[model samples]
Target chain A: MTVTPHELLAQMASTFRHEIGPAVDEPFAKTQAFMAAVILSKLAGQLQAAEADAQAAGDERRAVVAALRARLGSACPARLGDALTDLGHDGSDAAWSRLVGSLYAERDGLGADEFDALLGVVRSALRARLDRALAYAS
Target chain B: MTDAAAPVETRIAGYLAGKLGADDLRLRDVQRIAVGWSHETWLLDASWTADGVQHERGFCVRRDPGNALLREMSDLGVQFDVLRALEATPVPTPRAYFFEPGVDVLGAPFLVMEKVAGVCPSPWGSDGRRFYEAAAGRGVLPGSFTDALVAIHNVDWRAAGLDFLGVPALGTDFAAREIAKWRSLIDATGIQPDPVLTDLICWLEANVPSTDRLVLVHGAYRTGNLLIDDDRVSAVLDWETEVIGDPMYDVAYVLSELNRERTELLSNIVERDAFRRRYEQGTGIEIDDDACRYYQLLYAMRSAAFWMSATGLFASGRNTDLRLARTAWSIPVVLDNAARALGY
Candidate 1:
């Protein structure tokens, strides 16, 4: 659900392209196998992910960000406000990670209770992501 | 480049011949055994004649493939020295021998040591679980396991000249240095920094514990890392992560549920209470639960770093092993653990 599945599929496709296709005795068959691998990978990337998963994940991310911002109040630091903006705009995991870093960096100004409250938001989001991750994990 | 080619056994034999001062030397049972994730370990018997006396000795050759998970930390030469230092101690280990740094003799930098006789059963596997269960039922192995850890902690690292391991200053320096070590590994890898991991690292850094005692910590002290024979710990293996730090780091490892698979027995062998009693009695050092807790959290960060490094190695094409690629899944799994540990 996170980065694992896509990376796994890419690695598998690479193994097929680099090792499996190269092992073919006939040059024509090897070239064809390599071509098929590349085409199949491109197809799998767009087709593998369900629309339902993205929508559910987006809802969770939005809820986590909203709760965090609400806890920060209107007088929250500009850095945190901008981080949430980048997170919503880009919708990238890196954005979430940066928000986390920003929170820790601003912890001293936020004080103990506020910092803990904000951390709780990230923790809940992490657990939700972990629930999806367990599907790929052994 | 003769050593780099197909038959590595011949090269190893020729190298051993010169070292042993033997006119005719041969290697038997030269089979590679996957001892740990980092090093290429081969168990073999070297037979030869020196001074008109024939002899055969079991030797384990550990070679650094250069792309190992802990390649940045594990040193074969240092390991050889550590083994040599431990020869006078009660701790059971493979006797240190020749350590060759150059690739002229072997395909890679390899160290040959006296291979202690024992079988290391994987505590993570079902069959291995059954083996430990039976051994625990017999009741001696559990005590032996505890005693082995006790002996390791009891080692006078200063007297033994283990200070080359870079001792951290008293107090928070030990914990801080450890966090830096694992953090550096995470930084070196091109893996994405998961926020959960970032939070965990932040927590670990904010709460570095002070140590009262500094002893030789095995870093990974558990059933799988220990060699068992005759229901006793014949030797402790996997010295790659060994360090001169608080012994609680190793104790935290044994206390971890990661070593036990669906079992009540700690490390699938020793009972926690008995282990504590024997360990405390043997070492005259009380097990600090607080320190253990902090170290456990540090372990979570280290685990993430390890998996990230493994996946990074595969991703960078440094190593093409599918197993390394498979570890990409462990990043989330370990973060799941770290979050749970943090009560998230």
Candidate 2:
């Protein structure tokens, strides 16, 4: 009874191909329809995995902060240490939802350079956590 | 838009008359073949009567489109320059005749070039086995695809007169440059968080390997991009992404794809040790394993990032190339491979 975004996209794509696509005179309209289907399929796949992946990523980030605290001992910079401590405590789904929301809100405000720096920080934290996990498992 | 009948053809004919240094030149049977994401390619028939003889020719015009991904390289003159220089080399490229960089002629930068007749392998085509078979069956190509790649790498960059092109600063520090460029591309597109890709990029940066060897790298060299006839490469097309950087990047690109296919033909085509030895023999450069692995991982990451950016572009309506939208689905697969290469 309820149609999600993924289902709606698929329905629209099917309608376009069956109803509007045949009447279009554009040379590449058929190719465009096929491509739209491909994209819809990918979106469907992403919708299936996005929530689980986000949760896993948040847990992974928290683990990295704990490992960083252990590795830094007492020499870690005060600002970075404080940020890590804060991130470590706020590993709940609510925090992740808020972070995602804030990112969307600030998406246009952040320039390319600033966004890259932010991504770099997040990536570094994730990498450090992955390394710690590998070492522990090994 | 000009009338589809005689007026537009006559205008184009007039433009060519000036360039051809002849009178009574005319264009006939002009039709739009396909509009590429970057350029609009059209097939046209041209004829002119000079010195009591009639001459007819079939040629192609590649003109820039609005909001292309490679805006900086949109100048047909630059493409012409590269293709002209490559004429004397073993590299397979289309022969360029005239390059018009100004909008005064056709409202956009355009080039007239000799069209090579061949079937281009589609990366998204479902018939993967057929595609690989056709490529492998090109008898003129070397038994080892690496040999052809070695020939490309061994090209004299200085002799090619590309020094003026200004190689990237990351040429000397390839790993750093590779990471930075892709990161910049991702940032520019402003896509949503792709956790798998983000994780892979982090893994690649941390696992950077040390090496000093540098060679000409075809940024997107792979089976799909090459034109094969009679089991040999007739020509290597798509120089838009060419750069002088880590040679391992190209090698890793081929190897990573071949690894995915896992076919006996590909396996037998180039044994790891023999391929390296042959490449060194041909190019006089030794292959570095650690650096190759690092670049191989980098190539995968670059592919993932590029696909993500393309997806974002289409989704946001900045560009609406169906090919880019289709390619976005492969980003996860590429990221997974990059992660595997990084031993994550």
Candidate 3:
């Protein structure tokens, strides 16, 4: 009885092609209808996995920031770490946006050495989380 | 969509006729042909009487679509000018005849160029061997593709009198700049989140490699983009992505695509090691492994992002080409490869 993501995507793709594509008058518009269908298909695959992946990534990101904060003591910017920590707990869309934005902001503010150190930690954490998520899903 | 007369083609022929100082200029056989990703191309049969002499010629005219991925660099006149200037150089490019940047001529900017006859490796073709064989046999692909690339690198940009092109100076941080540029483009397009692509981009930025040498980077150098003939590269087509930066960008691109197909070829048209060795031998330029790996991953990621953007454009109803829409499906695969290359 349950409609899978794949099924939903297939339905959407067919609907877009048959119902929407033919109705489009402009060449560019017709192209968009087709692309939308393709993107929807891609998004379907991501949707099946992204939520769990993001949750795991959120946990790891928070852990990395906590460790960096501990090492740097008071000198470490509390704002970015705090934002990541909040995102880890609430797991809200706004929190995720803020977390990503803070990381980017910190990257811009900090020197390459400091930025890379932080980024390396973030990348390592994300990769570990992604691996875990993939393992769990499989 | 009208069949009467492709207005754009007629206008282009009219402009070319004026430039050639001829009367009774007619653009016949203006058949719309599909080529390249961004432009509407037409092959026209042009004829006129000059000094009581009748001359007919076949040429191509390309006009900009309303929306293009390379919109910032959509000045067809600039591309035409580059071709015009490069005609004197060893780099084989079509001879541009007329470049009209104004909208008055064709409802958009267009250019007319002498259409060189050759088989461009079609990406959609099934027979890879035939394509490579034809490319190698026609001398369209050099003994090593890398050698041809180095030849492009060896071109004295100064002697070409192309200072006006404002080729970016190569820097140690060239890879970083490139990463930032593509990232910005992805961000600007505001396409939906692609987690795999995002992860790949993050990985690439984190692992920026050192540059060993500086040379002209053909932003897009792959098998499908080149026109080949009789075992030699007749002409290198599509210079829209040409820039002055790390030479490894082009090297990495060619190596990644040609490596798989090289095994099947009789003469080893483009083996990765042989290509690199030949390039270094010919140009006295050393190849850097770390830089090559970085740029190879970068090329994959950049290509994926570009395709994503194209898909976005098509999805948003801004550009409608069935091929463009279909090609979007391949971006994720490329992104997956990029992620693997980056050890993600």
Candidate whose DockQ is highest: 1
- Write one digit per residue (lDDT tens) for candidate 1, span B1-344: 34557577887887788889997998888888873357988899989999999999999989998888889888899888899999999999989899999887676788999888888999888899999999999999999999989999999999999999999888889999999999999999966688788888888888899987899999989888989999999998778888889889988888988889989899999889998899999999889999998899899999999999998998899986656766777788888888988997
In angstroms, the error of model 3 at A52 is 7.0
Number of the predicted model whose TM-score against the real structure is largest: 1
lDDT of 3 by residue, B1-344 (tens): 12235556556766777777788888777778664367778877888888899988888788887677665544687778778778887776778888777676777777788777666655434576566765555654656465567668887767776556654544547777788778877776666535455656656666677665556566777666665655556667777777667777876766665234535432234545666678888778777777777787887767776777776777787876655666555665675566556555
Chain A only: TM-score per candidate = 0.63, 0.49, 0.54
- The most accurate candidate by lDDT is 1
Model 2 chain B lDDT-worst window of ten? B260-269
DockQ class, candidate 2? incorrect
Q: What is the interface RMSD of candidate 3, in Å?
A: 7.4
* Decoy 3 TM-score against native: 0.76
Error of 3 at B215 (Å): 3.3
lDDT of 2 at A97: 27
lDDT of 2 by residue, B1-344 (tens): 32234454565677676767659887666877546566677767788876778878766687776556654433567777877877777777777888877776667677887666554555445465566655555533334466668778887877987655446554346677668877887777766545545555655665566556556677777665666555666667666767677777777665555343545443223445556677778787766666767777777767766677777767778777787767655665565555555444
Computed on alpha carbons, the lDDT of every model, listed in order, comes to 0.84, 0.62, 0.66
Among all windows of 10 consecutive residues in model 3 chain B, the one with the lowest summed lDDT is B258-267
Residue A101 error, candidate 2, Å: 22
What TM-score quantifies how close candidate 2 is to the native fold?
A: 0.74
TM-score on B-chain, cand. 3? 0.85
